[model samples]
Target: MLTPWRLFLCQMALNIFYHIAKEIGEMESKWRLLHKANIKLCSQLIFTFITWQMSGYLTTKNSSLCLGGQDIFATVRENSPTGEIIAHLSINGDPGASSIRLCLTGENADWFYLEGRTIRLNSSFSRTLDREVLGSVLIAALTCYEDDIIRSRYRIMVEILNENDNMPYYLEDTIQPRYISELLTVNSMVFTVKARDGDGDTITYMTDKSTADASYFRIDLPNSGMVILDKPLDYETKTQLQVVIFAVETTTKEKYSTTATVTVNVLDGDDQYPQFQPCAPVYEDGDHNICTNPVYSVNITETDEDAVLYFSPGPIHAEDGDKDILTPLVYSILSGDGNGRFTIDSKTGEISLRQRVENRLLTPSFRLRIMAAQVNDPKKYSVATALVHVVSENRFPPFFNKTVYKGFLIESSSPATLVTTYGNQVLVVQAIDRDFRDGINPKIHYTMQPLTGSNKLYHISQDGIVIAKTDRLRAFDRHILEVIATDEESGETAHASVDIEVLQRGQPVPRSPFGEERLFGDMNAGMAGGIAALVLLVAVTVLFLFLWLAKRRRERRDPADRGAVALGKHPNVEASSPIAPRHVL
Candidate 1:
């Protein structure tokens, strides 16, 4: 502290100089020449003012008059009320109150005034004490004096204490939308934001959790002003993120805070390879997803050549997985076509055969590796399999042995009872395809073609077995079922009829209208002599009976011939003998 007694002296001396300068106007005024002789008086007054000094430094010469102390200090916050006392003026000598006076003066004197012994801010001044403009400390002088002579003087320092008056603010451009790539490395700095405190307080940064996208980012440090990515980014899920940042000051008595909203735009990165359409996802982890290309298949006959092949699932297609930018893709066959037997269109993934299949019996199926790659970048590509099955040409159409077949089933029997023919024999319907040995073709299929709507009472198996649902079949119910025989590869069909009669429970199945003959060709060479051998046996039995009859007739005719000879004398006897002989033969 600077003692007010000494500070007052310096302040008083400074005030005298200030008042003298204000009252003395310009010495060389226009009218001053009219009283040129008075210049001497003005010079004397100037001399007296120049020689004026306080007893402040009289200690070297032992002059007794002096102030108590020249070291005085005080503090007042910025924007302090006018008339707020900053320092008290004091004097050491025992001068009467009526003889001594005090005042504030110096370079910054106008900012304050004196009320007897106290120095305070002057509210009448147009400017106020703003810490932003006045800096840390304000300086002035205080002086005290006797009626005519300077007594003591001292310098006064009033520290301008800082106040939390300004709010923090962010630069206009720094908080605008920023573009970030989804392919950015983890734990890397995304962008930076900084806030300024006008009051010059140390500022720290923090993200507000109340915002929805706060979890995706974090502050690098309390005071770093650097925003970092807290987790990986996904463009597909979130294209933009908003973060609310708060810049605050806690060093002052009251907290000061400011907020800025930052938008981070996620840009699409060409980080994914081309993927085939109809994606089959196999694994998923948040935005990281994986899938496999499906294997496409199609069957063609060995005779087909130079034709565009169509696939089962769909035509071969692929696209860039980055949806925002659908980059064009090119297609080609990578392998399994070394002989150039197949060619593919690059833009449109179409496969065409070059020539006929020489030998499908040796190589039935071909697996070609098809690659789809981005046109701009060849390294980014995906490979899939195209399966082509070459089959033999179909020749013969299937046919049924009988146009219509009759079979009977007893009602009230267990479910899935088989129909029976004459003599309780199980009836079987068969179709013949001469292309195969034994007139049997595995490729041939059978189905019951409904003659009427809703045929739920019975069902047919793939192998042409007609089973009757006994529980559903009422007693004495008759059903006529139309069956179809199809040659699957040849696409030819043959139709036949199956007349099934549902007999009452405990009733026998009547004989077939076609007699004991077998309906199908399967009955050949079974438990019977062949037709040719039976004919030979019948002929031999007839010849033996004829020979025995001839022998009996000759024996009876010999007795008859002798009786006729004895009656040879009559003519009627001779004629009767010829007739008798003929009858006997």
Candidate 2:
């Protein structure tokens, strides 16, 4: 029905309308700029009004080209060539010879390129994704353009596939030395092994065959980085150990591993008690061990309070069973010598007196118990005993037991009445020398001093015996005698007084009074004095009462007589009104 020229015009008008509609769509969406040719064609078609109405009818039948903005996923081997094609993109609507162009946009555009409908790589990728540089996901937009006009956009994603290229290595280039106690229990975690894989693969840890005794150590696998001890360690045998560890990738096709050398130093622990050397012989007391010998004897010839008396109980030697080098043995006193008179050196275990032994009479000897223990473990110890003997020189005088003595005699008795005897005999003058243990003064002699009253009244013999000089007739006479005991060796003298009571013959001999009866007599005397005071008080009271009764009777009679006289003088005056003073009665 239409002519050739008209049909040609109609097709050109429809094409212009469709292009103008696309340009308007692109302007509304505000996508990336299209090519320079598409922009010039859209500007020229915009001036034709009839073409604008025809474009609506023609474009209504032809759907607009769209990319749907759907995401695409592709994976390629690592280190692939740049510009490698991954996948071809398809448009959803018809675009007829409009010069469709494709381009990448956004931050990932530098790494990717779009050629026609194909997505290609712009740069090579590493299998190990460096999130710090390229990030985890590559985000890019592929823009579709027709005749220099943008129609739609789509998102493209490309992931780099991993390759086994790098071996595992320790996380730290150089491992720090580790220290473990010798007393550490078996199967205890000593340290952790940290490693990393360049390919981001799971790493498994294992002890290398070159390690020192693999039976003593074990490694936990991928999940745990712990290295455990399989056997106990001793510092005495081996102080240090070297361990070789290997970290391998779990999923790598070719076994790729890295080695790390760790120096493990074994530390000392408080595992052994101190031991003493054979300085003295040890004696046992019912399962208890005691050290003897090294008998130290000192004669206390002089007295010095502040001087130090040094005596070596010999050097103390001890050794630890664990052979720990860091800790040493220390010595101390455990018991005996509670006064702290003896002290031992902590390092050498040598014993000495802190103060001088001034008097052997007081403390004759000292018994001390010394203990040696490890400084690290004080509770683990060993004990030994030391006996110290003291000898004393004669430096004191003889002392008498009693300062005075009493004796009785008859005035008219015969001569040699056997008054008293001394020197280890009956009624003797006892003297003791403190420097001797026997307490008896063997070199002591007794003599009597002259009496003042009668010169020859009494005499003392060499053996300490007092005898009457003559028969006397004096009643109630007392004689005093001084008996002196002298030490022949040291010339030290001790004296005692003897009081001799002379009683008349046939006079009742007085007996020594009992102590309890004397106390009872004193009580009776106090009670009698109290009774006499009470009797005197009662007698005084009775006399006062008798005088008072007599005075009252006289007062009564005087009043009756006055009444008779007053009645005769004036009847108004009453005579019975006058009374005696109360104090008089």
Candidate 3:
């Protein structure tokens, strides 16, 4: 293979020299001009021509200037600083090769400079030599000069070796933040990020291992740059997530890399069951909390029947776990229905008793497991425990101290301030339950029932303190609310009226024995009662005197008047009326 390649190269060189000799022969006059100016160069050329004729080829081309090829190849790494020596030049045919004079010229000539026998990079054109921009090879003409004339010329092909200089960049529109439903299956592709390396190195993708959301994702195929979900997504625990991806050049010793942020917008999916409110939240991710529903409870008397029950810690309410997707929910008494005695409203979640509890001595309490399920998807459901305590029948119902309560609220007060009455004292709406010794029944619950459609302006705490958001109320705004006190255990309730008036800022409350001055007018009732009694006495005396005068006048006018005015034992009167003998004057 070597011998045949050499013969072919020799033949190609012979044809190239033949064409050069024919051209030189035609430029005889120019050669003479050069011979006259520089005899040494002409004489050398003549000897070279004679030798070419004798050997039948220009073997001089193969000396050191030519090695059966026209190009002088060299290699240098890209990004090499200026003055970096990449190649050493030589003129092997000439004894003083190390000291030979050489010149560079071509498209890439400025990229290099000659120093003695060494060639170095000259990067005055850019900040640094870039393989991506300069391409694989840099080309230039390297010529050996003798006597200030070009003796031989060759092409310099500097191979630009690659380096891990550039960071990988994501291609346009290759990756973007995504909003995905939490119901997305595990191991599903969430993102496909593509990047390119200028050096054409193999790229490997990696997720940030130290982040919390990293465990939720995995890069199964390192080279594919596909991001997959490693676990289930729960919108209840986390609504949003961030992932950091790294595009790395693995084969490079320096391991160049670039990073970008990916946001996983977890949308709500109808995949979770309804949860009882006043949620019992647990920290699922240290940074975010996940909530679980709580149990419900209420009490009913042994004789309770056909009565609706209100459970506490809030009502028997369950909200869909997916907050954004509030699908309709229905309630049912899954267990402890009390043998068809207990019934539940499918829509309102109200538990009612259809039959009376026969005996409290036998059954003290009923454990009711109530289930709330989404109407669209019944399988997605949750059960809450309802404890119903069955106690003896209530002998007496609760009653408020006053049939009507008058509460005063300052318009300048904040939402958290309690309602006050005259003299700036806290106004309490209290109830008395004769059944309880202290008249304070633990089972009695108070609520401020709205008289109108809106009740958000005021709130009544369990202790019967009315709090109004005075910021939402104007001065002199009067609100009438019906307050109800119900026995939570006996299901007996009492109602009372509350007149809440909004007072202007800095307006003084009237001093009165009764709470509010307007509700109970300011008047001395004791003095007024005494004056009324004295007037009644005077009227009685005056009426008696007038009656006596009338009787005397009538008796003097007529005997009949005397008889009519006389008592049964009248004194001896005139005998004109002997028939009325008993008449007394």
Most accurate candidate by lDDT: 3
Candidate 2 residue runs with Cα over 4 Å from true position: 1-72, 89-100, 115-117, 124-136, 173-175, 220-222, 275-314, 319-347, 351-371, 374-378, 383-585
Candidate 3, position 80, lDDT:
85
Kindly list the per-residue Cα lDDT of model 3 for residues 170-247, writing each as its tens digit.
875666778989999999998888999988999999999998788888898999999999988988778888888999
Can you give the lDDT of residue 356 in candidate 1? 75
Judged by lDDT against the true structure, how good is candidate 3?
A: 0.78
User: Candidate 3: which stretches are off by over 4 Å?
Assistant: 1-70, 81-105, 113-120, 142-153, 167-176, 192-196, 245-249, 256-261, 278-316, 330-372, 381-432, 435-585
- Estimate, for each residue in 396-429, the C-alpha lDDT of model 2 and write its tens digit: 8887777777666655646566563222123455
Assess candidate 1 and give its lDDT. Answer: 0.77
Off by over 4 Å in 1: 1-73, 90-110, 114-116, 123-128, 139-156, 209-215, 283-288, 297-305, 310-313, 324-328, 356-365, 374-379, 389-585
Q: Give the number of the best model, judged by TM-score.
A: 1
Clashes of each: 20, 4, 2
List the candidates' TM-scores in order: 0.49, 0.42, 0.46
Model 2 lDDT vs. the true structure? 0.65
Query: Candidate 3: lDDT of 481?
Result: 90
